[model samples]
Structure formats: structure tokens, C-alpha cells
Target: MSGVVFLILLLLGLPLAFTLIASGMVYFAQNPELPTAVAVQRMVAASQSFPLLAVPFFILAGHVMNCSGITKRLIHVSNLLVAWISGGLAHVTIVLSALMGGVSGSAIADAAMQARILGEPMQASGLSKGFSAATITVSALITACIPPSIGLILYGYMGNVSIGKLFLAGLIPGLLLTLVLMLVVYLQARKKGFAPTQANPPSFKQILEAINQSKWALLFPVLLIVTIRFGIFTPSEAGAFAVLYACVVGRFAYRELTLSDITTSLSESVSDIGMIMLIILASGVVGYAIAYEQLPVSLTLAVTQVTEQPQLILLMALAILLVVGVVMEGTITVLLLTPILVPLMQSVGVDPVHFGILMLIMVTLGGTTPPVGIAMYAVCNILRCSTTDYVKAAVPLFIAVLALVVVLALYPPLVLFIPELLF
Candidate 1:
């Protein structure tokens, strides 16, 4: 009955946090012996987690990197690397996304920023708006896969998985996705008659200059990995280092970060942190309710009854997560579902890190899909392309991504290779 009410409230469009609190309140009312103070305690305890401190620090670091002019330099370097290829601008979008993945770690933000910066130029250069929009949305998936990803952080926190392992594990798969998407973009551009932005490949001197100029931005992720690997800091502590690194790089190294920029970055980080923490807090309540109702055990038993094969069960779970992600916010879905699914995966002897990567990919990919995909809407709105056109342009790319997901699923080494090598 409590579960039903909670679903009804969520479907009726109440904010997730409010629906959670309201549902918990009703559960309390139905059992007067249950103390209302428990809700307060849970909410407070959720915020008190040391792992969660990574969330705010990373958020602030992302904003700081953007404000400090690191993002623009990275974009310039990405352009230099790919602008000589056929469908150069589209390749630019892909490469830029992969680079931005390390800095921003938010797909929606990457899509919107890319659309704003590159959409008009691409359209004016005879590229279709829908194609541009599709590429931006899909490539932005890279952001969610890279290190410092908030999605991975949340998954680690809720699933009791190692944050550093998740971060290291994503490296190769993310680059592979980039390579595949780049090929798709090239073929699509050839089909559509999209020409290279530059007639010749950039000279070695130009390439060297671009790299030197963007070295600071490039070194950020390396520093993070080294710091975490050496046990110099936990993932959360590394996040604090990230912020300080960005500040120093922006203010002293690049001489671009100003006092005003620092203030604005803080303001942006505060709002982002508030939204994320609220969803997480609400999810903590929902998670507690799910546990109180024995949802995980029931779900595990039901799923095991249908399939004893670990791979098949994982595929089924991935399919469910993909569908759920199409409508639900990725962070919310991760927080709500990780607990329910992790134990089930363990029962089947699947590595939690591998499953975590698969789960994160599904949810993040969902944001690029239709109906309620936040990144999709963001890109389409920026490009002024119809949903139908975007979907048409996106179909081939979507198929490519789905195929990649299948390959990753069938061969877990695609994700595990990097973590094993690095760790």
C-alpha cells in the first residue's frame, strides 16, 4: 500500500523529494508507533556521509574549470586534432565531447554547451541541424563515462562500490565509444556531403601549439588518477584537489580566472549541489522504504526464478534499466535502483564494478533518448530541430551505441581491462 502511494505520487508529477517525504509521512501515520523523527534522522544521516562530500567538490571543480577558461582551450585543441578529418566539424563535436568528458562530467551540460558553441556554425556550413543535434547529444555520453563523473560517484556511494575503481574502469570504454562515434559521424557526413572545415591537416607546429596551450586542461585527469592511485587521497579528497587545481590553473597558469568568475562558479555549484543532494536525500528515503518492504529479496527471487544464467539475467536487467532511464532522471534512477540491483548481480557472481559501468551507461544513454531525455531536449531546443528530425538523424547513431552496449555486455573485459591494468 505504501509503495503504491509512492508510485502514484511520483507518476502524478510531484517532485521526487516531496513524493518521498509525503510517502514516508503516510507510512508513519499508518503506524503511529513508528517515530516521525526517523525520517529526520535518515535525511540528516544521508548528508553526513564522507563519500558524499565528493559530490559537492566535484560539482564546484566542474564549474570552476568552465569559468576559468579551461573549457575553451580544450575545445580549441579538440578542433585542431579533428578539424582536418572529413566531416571535420562533426568530428570536432565528438573529440570535444571526449575532452570535455574529463572536465565537465555532465552529459547534459556538455550537450547544451556544444550546441550553443558549434550548432550555428555547423548549420551555416551546410550541416543539417538535426545531424548536428544528434551528434552533440550522443557524443555527450562520453562525459558521463569519464573520471569525476557524478553518476559513478552516486553509484559508488549507494552500492558500496569503489569510486576509484569505477573511475579507472571507464577510461578505455569511454575512448572506444569516442572512436566508434567518430567513425559513424564520418560516414554520416560523407553521406550528407559534409566537407572538412580545413582543406589540409593541421601542421605539426600547429598541433604542437594546440597541445602546449591546452596542456593544463589535459593534465587534470592524469593528476587525479595518480593522486588516487598512490593513496594520496580518497576520491572525495581528490575532488577537493580538483577544485584547487582548477583555481590555480585558471588564475595563475592561464591567467583567465577572475574574482568574478570564482563567485559565479560558486553560485552555480551551490545550485547544482542542492539539486543533486535533494534527489539523493529523497532517494535515501525511497531506498529505505524499498528495504522496509523487502523489495530487493523479492526482486532477486523473482528474477532468479526466471533465469539462472548470469549473463541472461544481466541482459534483462540492462534492458529494464534502459527503459527506466528513458523517462527517469539518470541520477535519481541510479540512486533508486543501484541498491535493488547490486545484490542480485552479486548472487550471480558478476563483478559489481562491471555491472556498475553497464548500469551507468544505460542510464546516461537514456538521457540521449526520446520522450523525456533531458540531453536530447537540450540539444534539439538549441538547434531548433524538430523531434522527428532529431530522431531520424539519431537512429543510426543510436543503433551503433546499442550495438556497442551489447558488445560490452557480452565481453566484460572491455570495461574491466583498464581497471585491472591501472589498479
Candidate 2:
């Protein structure tokens, strides 16, 4: 009954956090035998987590970096390295996103940022509005997999997996996605006769200068992982360090950060943090109700009855996520589903960290897709491209991503290798 209400409320366009809270209240209303206080208790308990501190700090750091002129430097670096490629600006979009992954950590944020900065240039260079918007939006998927990813942090918090391990796990997959998207851009650009942005390759000196200028930005993720892996800081503390690091880099190294920037970053962080944490808290009620009902146990039993194969079971879960993702926002989906699916995958002998990467990617990818794709709307709106045109241009890029997803799904080591080696 609560599930049906959730779906109905969601389809009616109620805010996700409110929908979750209301549905949770309904669940309690439906079961008067249970104490009503449980719902409030669950909501409060959700906010008491220590590790959940990572979300706000990282979000603050991302906003700080964006304001500090870090994004501009990375964009400059990306253009230096990739602007001579056949698809020039398209490749720049992919590389910039790969670089932004460490800085932004949110796919929608990355997509909007890129669309604002790169979209006009791509179209002016003769790329269609649809293709440009599609490229910018799809490239943001790299942000979903990279270190400091908020989705991974939430998955780690909810599933009780190591946040550091999940961060490491995302590194290889993020790079792989970058390469795959670049290839797609190259082929598509060639077919469309899209010329290079630069006639000549960057000189060795230019490459060195570019990297030197952005070295601090590039080093952040590496430092984040090392500190966490070697016990220098907990993930929460690493987040604090991230904020400090961004401030110092922006204010001193780049000399682009200002007092006003810090104030703006704080303001933006508060809103982003509030929205995400509220959804998480609301999910606590739903989570408690699900647990009280032993939903994981029942679902695991039901799934295992159909097939014991871990890969096949994972495929089934992915399919379901794909469908759900089209309608729900990614963060909401992650919060609502992680508690249920993590245990189900664990029962089938799937590594939670491995599954986490796949799950985050699929859910985040959902935002680039259909009727309720926030990222899609964000990018398309910025580029002034229609949804129909964007979808048509995004098909090949989507195929590339789906193929990579299948490969990662079949081969667990690809996702787990980095974390295992470091830890």
C-alpha cells in the first residue's frame, strides 16, 4: 500500500523528499499496531550518522572549486590536450568531464556546467544542438564514477561498505568511460565531418604548462584516496580536507577565489546538502518499514528461487533500476533502493563495492535519459535543444555506455582491482 502511494505521489510530481515522508507516514497509518514514534525516530536516526558528514563537505568543496576558477583551468587544460582531435570540441567535452569528475562529483552538476561552458562553442563550430547537448550530458557520467562522488558516498553510508574502497573502485571505471565516450565522439564527428578546433597539436611546453597550472586540481582525488587508504583521515575528515584544499588552491595557488566566492559556496552547499540529506532522512522511515517487514529476506528468497547465478541476478536488478531510474531522480533512487538491493546482491555472492559502481552508474545514467531526466533537461535547456533531438543524438553515446556497463558487470575485477590493490 505504501509502495503504491509512493508511485502515485511520484507520478503526480510531488517532491521526492515529501513523497517519501508522506508515504512513510502512510505505512505507519496502515499499521496502527506499530508505534507511530518509529517514523520520527527513524528520520532522526538517519541524520545521526557520522560518516554521512562527507556529503556536505564534499558538496561545499565542489562549489568552492567551481567558484575558485578551478573549472576554467581544467577547461583550458582539456582544450590544450584534446582540441586537436578530430571531434575537437566533442573530445574536449569528454576530457573536461573526466577532469571535472574529481571536482564536481555530481553528474547533473557536471552536465549543466559543461553545457553552459561548452555547448555554444560546439554548436558554433558546426555541431548540432542535439549532439552538443547529448555529448555534454553523457560525458558527465564520468563524474558519477570518480572519487568524491556523492552517490558513492551515500551508497557507502547506506550499505556499510568502505567509502574509500568505493572511491578507488570508481577510478578505473571513470577512465574507461572517458575513453569509450571519446571513441563514440570520434566516430560520430568523422561521419558528420566535424573539424578539429585546433589545426595543430599542443606543443610539449604547452602541455607541461597546462598540467602545471592545473596540477593542484588534478592531485585532489589522488590525495583523497591516499589519505583515506593509509588512515590519514576518515572519509568525513577527508571531506573537510577537501574543503580546505579547494580554498587554498583557489585563493592562493590560482588567486581566483574571493571572500564573496566562499560566501556563495557556503550558500550553495547549504541548499544542496539540505535537499540530499532530507531525502536520506525521509528514506529512513521507508527503510525502517521495509526492514520491519523483512523485505530483503523475502525478496532474496524470491529472487534466488528464480536463479542462483550472481551475474544473471545482477542483470535482473540492473533492468529494474533502468526502468525505475527513468522516472525517479538518481539520488532519490539511490537512497530508496540501496538498502534493499545491496543485501539482495550480497546474498547472491556479489561484491557490494562492485555492485555499487554498476548501480550508481545505471541510476545516474537514468538522469540522461527520458521523461524525468533532470540532467537531460538541464543540459538541453542550457543548449536550447529539444528533448526529441537530444535523444536522437544521444543514442550512440548511450549504446557505448551500456556496452561498457555490460563488460564491467561480467568482469568484477575490473571495478574491484584498484581498491583491492590500494587497500
> RMSD for each model, in Å, please?
1.6, 1.2
Misplaced by over 4 Å in model 2 are 102-105
Top-lDDT structure, candidate number: 2
- Put down candidate 1 lDDT per residue, 1-423, tens digits, no spaces: 666787898789888778777887777777777687876777777787898988889889989988888888988998888887877788888888777653444668778888999999878767887898999898887777788788888889999998889988888778988999999889988898898888889899999998999999989888887888779999889999999999999999999999999999999888878887887787766677677778889998999999899999999999999888887777888888999999999988888999988888888888889988888998898889999999998998889988988898889998998788877
Query: Each candidate: what lDDT?
Result: 0.85, 0.89
**Cα-lDDT of candidate 1:** 0.85
**What's the C-alpha lDDT at position 348 in model 1?**
89
Over 48-106, each residue of candidate 2 has an lDDT whose tens digit, in order, gives 99999988999999899889888788889999899898888988989887776634546
Pairs with backbone N, CA or C atoms under 3 Å apart (clashes), candidate 2: none
lDDT, residue 14, model 1: 89
State each candidate's clash count. Answer: 0, 0
TM-score of 1: 0.96
